[model samples]
Target chain A: MELTRHYLIRRFREYYHKAKIYEPIEFRMREWAFVPLKNFPDFVMVRHVSFSEMEELREFLISNVPAHVYFSSAYYLKPSAEMDEKGWTGADLIFDIDYDHLPTKSLESAKREVFKLLRILEKDFGIDEKEIEVCFSGNRGYHVHVYDERFRELGNMERREIVDYLTLRGFKLKGTQFDRVCKIIHRYVRDGKVNVDEKTGEILRSSLNEIRKGRLDLIPPEVREELIERCLKKLVVHVDPPVTADVKRLIRLPNSLHGKTGFRVVLIDLNDLESFNPYVDAVAFGDESVKVRLLKKVRVNFGGERYILERGRHSLPEYLAVFLMCRGVALYGH
Target chain B: MRRPFLPILPYLERYPFLKIGSKLFKFSKDEVLSNVEKARDFVEKVLEDKVEFDFKPIDFLCSNCGIREECEGYEGCSYNISSAEYHLKLSRAKKAVLNWLRCKVVVSNLDEFLRRRFAVKLARLYRDLILKECDDFILFMADDFGLNHEGFSIHVADYLKYAVRMKSDDWKLVNRFLSKGYVDLSRNEFVRLMEKVIKEILMEKVQINLNVRLKVDFKRKELERLPLKVECFPECMKSILSDLNEGKNVPHTGRFAIASFLINIGYDVENVVDVFRNAPDFDEDKTRYQVEHIAGLRGKGERYVAPSCETMKSWGLCVWSCEVDHPIKFYRRCLSGGDKGKRSSKRKGDSQDYA
Candidate 1:
């Protein structure tokens, strides 16, 4: 049987009341939007809030639980006003790395990709360890927030440039000094401006030319092909560019329960990011068994475990039951 | 005995020529043959530091002197020297240092070149001795030498100076440090320093997670002016740009569609690449190469065409219908005239051609 919207909202409120909510930096200045179950998804009410006002907001949520909760990445003097009139201040640099956005079939690789982007920010950009924050989306993604004071006022073009650098967009091999060395040694260009043999005269041009022509047999023992390969590999990182570029974006509020998954969007430490499994770690409901009627044959991976469902009645953990019911695919009291 | 006025050895060595009243001459024993023995004995005693000699009335060249710019004299001129000579020396020093760092010089003669060349030795003088011995010379060099002029030459000396300037504001201390001399470092150590400095500079250039927006409004006004909006875009390409702009990772195929469509529509490679800046793992060189490849600027000279509307529909990328068989046709029609000829026979002809 399908749970009534009222029952779903009530359970969500209970989960919210029991869970420990994360406090985002400068939480008081953020704009919040709530979509109620009674209205269309597009219909949302926005409000400006401070940390001190969170208790009242929580009380409102508990009374009439929203279907979805979203917070602006931007800060404003007066939020919930007309777009042109709101006294917008600044925003945090947020990155949303979603598994569904990538073509990878397994969630494992997608999570690895997220780590890869984060590592670039840490190692290449030299961002301080504490300045970067990672969190689970409570569904199929990771969100990274950068709260460095230096980045607050960057415009979209500058943000886009950062994204370009990270993603290797418009990066030219011809412009790189290392690649120029490789090209000169291998005679890829006819310009005599680059004379590499003067240093290591042992590198004969005939052999280099043969190697350049794809005749690997003519490769000299002194030539380290790996050097060129390594330089080439250093050129690019695959990432979603728009996240860094969009200044006025909305992000799912941390510590809020996801409407569909019945999972909590929790902040995760960078050290613990690799081992974080959203299905297991973010489950908001208790382990009480509940009877749910499956609407169709489906497979799900949740809470670090997999479940296969057939088109029939089945007993599931309370969180999974709520997840399916909220997804509108199963009836909990059939 | 006719006493010859013998000059101070340190001052003489720094300025080998002596001004006899108005005319400057090399300090030769022939000029004062009557007291040659006395001069020789005075020079020997002065060299041995056994006797202190008084400084001669030296004539320093002024900047206005004709010989100042071109003079290669070993010591101070009879007239005041021009800053142009100092600038020339500094420029050469920067070039020599950069050349050595870039491995442009013959490895065997590097030490000899460094010691003999004015360019190389002058750099050493500033970096090791002059800055400590005299503040005026360092000030002179600093005023004459420019960081902007050193093109394509990466030297640790300049990099260190830049780093120091970036860190501290005390010019006196910085000048003192420069004069006190850099530690004797191996060639490889210098190279490593240059590499580290370059990497730091690159990191600064590639700033990450700056919460800034584009000052140049990203809205393509021309695109907006077209009769067709994003609704005309194949769902795949539209979603790809949206996802990229929103910082959501997109499938490779989605990226390919956007790139191909943008390239086909005559968007510059940089603009096309800008669209992908929000991609999760972006690399400028790689994206440029990829976009260039799709644009037929790289690879085997074959420009990639955007996938057909029917193919996009098959891939579930077509969420709306415009009755056009191809994406290019839709875009073309949109650019030409939007909705005015919605029921035109031109679309019918395109449908029949595909059918």
Candidate 2:
């Protein structure tokens, strides 16, 4: 089902011709990179590219029609120079919540994780709701960026702590700080909020008095661990570590089309995120009929349509056809 | 302040103190000359003391950790700090003398090295005194940062300046008492960061002269001379070398690490190039140029060292858990022909000024 490089490039060009790709915030201060749609599933990014004017980025997008467009999260004095030569001014603190990295690997899980992350950022980190910019990655995750000047100059170690805070990595529930974790476990065990086997549940039920008193050892170690794990699961926010830690990371640009699924990398307000549907809302192509040879059986479920297709030549709406073709599950011009 | 004398100082930040001694510390010629002798005596006394520091949690519910609910630390401050303040200031005055010495002059890496050790030693004493006096001083410092201590937490934004500087995993926010809108700290946590801040500030001011000679003879033993021994190579390095010698397409990190290690271990560019002869895509000109570049001949002209053991582990180059912090440490162990050999080289003499 691998599409030819020429096919993807040609298809990508058509989308860019009318894509209306917009620049990221602080466009002139950031470095840009592009990995052209070629050699399916493999790409070498061309970076250290910048633009002084609006027309340059626009013209370049039209000419290049990059498969995956990215811009540095950091602001640099010389955006097009070598890494060491480019003076580092500041960077946006980024958090990535990819569904693939989650235990369930479901979009529903990713949404829940993003909510947990937002809560921690808003609550623990005290980052304002308005200051947090959440964007659909146009693929499998959400990219949350904080452009607050206070958080910008945080070095790698500081960001490492922030990530560790979100994930609760190496957090121990035994000493001076264990009181909070004990409280969390107590509520879960006492209220039967934890999911465990009947015997473990019975143990938790039997140890209600001890649990209420924050004495976890009154129950079996297995049940104790299970309760603690499940309780903390609600508290831990799953984020891709490197995306947040790496100051120089080049993130997929908003408003640019994700070359893989031919969807727009769009931003969503915090209020609207609950109902945000990437497949439906992120679709950039219109419903003009187009010919495509389906090489693999696949399902198209969003954008107010559902089609379980077979392997054959079929005339589909341009929106559906482009998605299938760009995903490399089909070929153009049946 | 009194301490045992250091034989020879360790390698420390030398440039700031030596290169800009007078301008940095803002001392006049007479003031610098006279105080240098006084500062040397003060440093000798300060270095003579054995500083013992330990933080054991007392399990007592402490307040003023910027958190209101609860905190971990020793007993809370229960007494008036009128004398405590005087005691703290006395230490500060003594430390200021050493601070001036640290900033004013450093022979090679001499004073620079001693300053770092002095700061930490003094800081440990400072932290204990602060704890004994009560968290009032700690709270006072936090207030300077606009950090408000409430029920077992401080707002993350308010405390990041101090917390961000904490390197240990135990000091990570995850290990702290976390609540909605706050990160909790114990008494020890506050004092630890406060101590580090004291140490950093301690190194910022000092007095000494640009033209002075020490009547001390000491080998530069801090910069260890390691022999070119392949057998002494750590497993991580050995694997990379063998891979290149076997015409394998080693990862970029592996190649850089091996090349840096070879260059650091006294391999000539031509000799290193010969090792890469069997590389998958070996090109003589490119290999030689890269080797030369790593040897600090071209571009930045900064010689590269092999990545540390932690970095090696991160890069997945480590084949086994080598009991050393760096590949070079492993090599040193091999050369010593033991598991871990210790060395002590000390040279002590009074530094005299010559007109």
Candidate 3:
């Protein structure tokens, strides 16, 4: 009999019971094919049970394998409400530990940091070197396998207590704690003792500083407020000087109320068209032809957009005003 | 023994004919003037001042005369005697003046016209022959003047050979016309043909020589010193570099073979060279060897030997060596029976697609 069957049951209970001792309700074991573990036993058998009876199963597995082992829940847990309804699956036991996610840029330095973390686990947490196995999960993470068999018959509550004890003793869940641990490992790897080049050294140092300052998370509230002020100043630079006051007032108003009631109005002079038309040889008939040609050229270069053309009267001042308005709209509108 | 009065004799002879013709036709002064004007106009326009007049009417008549010993055509005839006697009677200064005057007007005009239309020296020779009035010399001058000129006739054979080599229809036509002399060639006609042939040959020679020189320069200056960064053993790079330096002659011959091969496969020379230039770590010797070998293979009706991975690895230094997405992948395909024929066929297809 291989150790993983008993070891797996103990690990399952440790997370569930949140205690080191309990009574068993039921226990059943099934023979499985021999799947070679990288750093553990050659074969693995599995035990199945209800959540209530998980403690005794843990006790039973624990006694069989006294070697140090790693454990996790068989299902992923998320903070969202929609995820809570779905019961956990056994696949969650395979937590991915990505060494590359270390805040450093140099791959070699990052890998060394991962080794340092593993060394801590081996020496401080009493994890067995022989029982540990590393796997590339084909993405960003690595799967560290521990096949030590112990507390195989422990009840769920008892197993949970052991996990609680370990948690308190500094073993972390997958969040900020995990992120910190990864950073520490990466730091040791990036120490100047390695044969890394100067460029890699600079990148590693910069990345470490970023992690330390927690800049990886969202920008702080104060920073966000400053950014908004900067954006307003940029907008002010682009606005016309004549409309600067109105634009500033518009910018100060909230978006919802401003959209409901327009805040800024632009008035353009339209008297130039009277003299301009004669210079351009644009009579009423020729006006249409010139307009068509101009529109075609515009379409060729700038494409067309839908706009409401407000034609007041056929007077020169009205035409000039309309032309100015069209120019403004073409310059600024979508 | 008396002065021959040659000017008055010609006038007298012409007067009798003029009088008889006027009587027979009963032409008025207006009609006569019109007739003279019309004749002069026709002569000026049609002949372009190139016609010759017969001054020795007695000699002309005697040459056509049937009597033996008295006719110019007869051996030791009286025509020669009359010509000698006529020549002896003229003052030396008068004869010199007449010859000088003829040379200035007739000979100079013919020479200028021939020079403009034909070649330089031949026109000068034609002028000389006209001035000398040596009929025997004129025929020889004509033979040696244009396309049939003594030294230039060899170009006809050379052009024929070149046409056969190039397999061009225009060149073939030129070759055929020149070799057989089938076209009716006057001095001017021959000169035009010769000029055309010379121009074409000069142009083609210039183009080919430029192409060859550029290809050689590219191989020597640019392609040979490619920056090849091999992640493999340093020995491989060393050996490759050695092989390239040792087989340096390959690019020279290879340029010709490769250009010919590309042209045969319907690629322009520039495109082929450009493709070769941009190919990564392209082994000039190997590429040249392969192209030449493949062309030979094609000639022999044998299958083209696809390049190996090593060959392609060398080729992959330049970006445009092959069409595969990756250099390694291209090498793999080349190793795994990638069709040389298909690649060439694809190039033809691509050219058509672009067109």
Candidate 4:
């Protein structure tokens, strides 16, 4: 697999200005880090830039086009050269819903998992939808950012508790204390009366009992247990553990180009997530054809289209060629 | 020129029991703001002079301290200035602030626009003055509200309804505090703001009150009480009672479950106390008070419910599938003269309930 440096450099110069870098409200008060070059691979940290100097930072990106760009989730007061020296401020609670953590391998399955987590965050924790920001990671997953101020102040232990609640870990089936009567057959119970047999005068157990003809003399004892088991099943939402637990961890910048996928890190509308196809929506390049040489036979399924390539020169769409080159499976041909 | 402690005055009059030390104080918005200002001045004064509260214990007063019985020279004497003088002062300050919040402070006299405007200014002042030094307190308060625990203590939610007769009445205000955006207050923003300010002003000693006492043991004695039937008890309850009867140590959850279970089944506080008398570490007064608290005869007048089947399962105390949803349901059947020997027959056709 080969990738031409000149092609990447030229592409970065052309489209780097258009790339969007997510900045905290206090941008200057954060520690920024970036991969200077693909060959170097090491992330050079301890960089700081004010809002006014964003243009200079953009120009630097145009010149170098770092392999990856990241700003600390944390807002620091000192933001020194060493991490320990920096005074910690609060951060946005970001959940990395990667495909690997999901029960199924498909992106569709990952989306379902992400939605389940979103539901738990909303219904259980009462976090508002507007406070949550969803971003496609431009590779293999989604990044959900909860910008709610309440979550920002949560420590690692508290954040782990949220993860525990989501995953249903440490959830005891017998410990659930509900003051209200169980809802399962309560709907059928009208005016404090259960359907009863007239002749023998026995109270019939309603919908919750399988005994259609037999009289339910008492409230079923297992009604609460059954409801709890169902609740436990619904509560088990899979999430990438490390991502939620790390309060100070840096995340992929939203709307910025992912160096590995050659696709833009796209911001998704929570209401429109069902229709959001990352490959189609996040293509940063035009459809003009470009010549590329595949180092090996490559089969790519992107957007709605699929392509099979042999180890030879082929004229492909500009976006597909760039994607292949970025993936390091093809080279720019003269 | 200031609002006449309008919102909180009624609350203080209603709940005379909400005393901050010797004084049953009526705390207002102005009082809270003024306290913040005072605490700021105190912080600066103490920081400048380095006049710190000494945590060291004085050896002579160890016998007279209220907590000396439990202290046993192991957890150190509680006779220090921090606990004696400053701790009381802190507890009072905390109660004042908590009472201020407990009384919903929306004013009819002030203009709606001015109210929000003043609220924003106050929120910002609290954020700047209090948040920097007392972040841990704020975090603790948040957790204290958010997490549910098995105990006979007053939760933040309980305090929110300081004078409210019913949970539903207080829940209406809580729902408003948490519901969709209230003009300038965007969803739970107000709650978060109030929590931070309250935490900053509140002293750590009074943040959680777990002390329980029996106020009406006579009234409790008049109520019809039943003998605890161990044979008919749920597995979890039976296990806890067995542990206590054998003078074996049980966890707090177990104690809570047992206390809640016995009380819910119409057993009086004294009977419940007798059940725990054999426990190795049982204290008669403490056990009686805790039992009274769980029986809803003391403290907040709210009886503790037995931990649900799910809670027992989580605690790893749920041993058998009794096919009952709640421990209370099992106990209710036994207490109501339902056939205990014929209980197994009730489980025969209940496939869907088990499913």
Listed models, DockQ each: 0.01, 0.32, 0.00, 0.01
Cα shift from native, residue A123, model 3 (Å): 99
**Candidate 1 lDDT, B152-203, residue by residue in tens:** 2222234333333231222111111111112222333333333333323212
lDDT of 2 by residue, A252-318 (tens): 8888888778888888889989999887778887788888888878887764577899998899987
Model 1: CA > 4 A from native: A38-52, A174-238, B1-355
Off by over 4 Å in 4: A1-3, A38-52, A174-234, B1-355
Report every candidate's CA lDDT. 0.54, 0.67, 0.29, 0.56
Off by over 4 Å in 2: A1-26, A36-44, A52-56, A59-64, A174-184, A191-214, A229-236, A293-312, A329-331, B1-115, B128-136, B142-169, B180-182, B202-355
* Native contact fraction, candidates in order: 0.00, 0.48, 0.00, 0.00
Off by over 4 Å in 3: A1-334, B1-140, B145-188, B193-349, B353-355
Question: Per-residue alpha-carbon lDDT of model 3 for A1-334, expressed as tens digits?
Answer: 1232232234323333442332211111111111112223233422222232445435433333311122222222321113223232222111123434344433233334335434533543344555444432222223333333321222222222222222221122132233343354345434653234677556545676663443333323453345333322321111111111110011110010011011111110122311222212211111221111121212111112233333332222222222322232211111
Query: In DockQ terms, which candidate is top?
Result: 2
Best-to-worst TM-score order: 2, 4, 1, 3
Residue B4, candidate 4: Cα error in Å is 9.1
Report the C-alpha displacement of residue A257, candidate 3, in angstroms.
99
Worst window of 10 by summed lDDT in candidate 1 chain A: A172-181
Give the per-residue lDDT digits (tens) of candidate 3, residues B1-355.
2223332222223221212222222333333333233333322322243433333322222324455343332123333235555554334323333322222222223322221222223233323323332322222223322223333232332222222223222332221222221222344333334344333321221111110111111112221122222321122222333444454433332343334433343343344444455444566665555554444433222223222223334343221223443333332334345454126323322444334
State the interface C-alpha RMSD of candidate 1: 15.8
Candidate 1 chain B, poorest ten consecutive residues by summed lDDT: B172-181
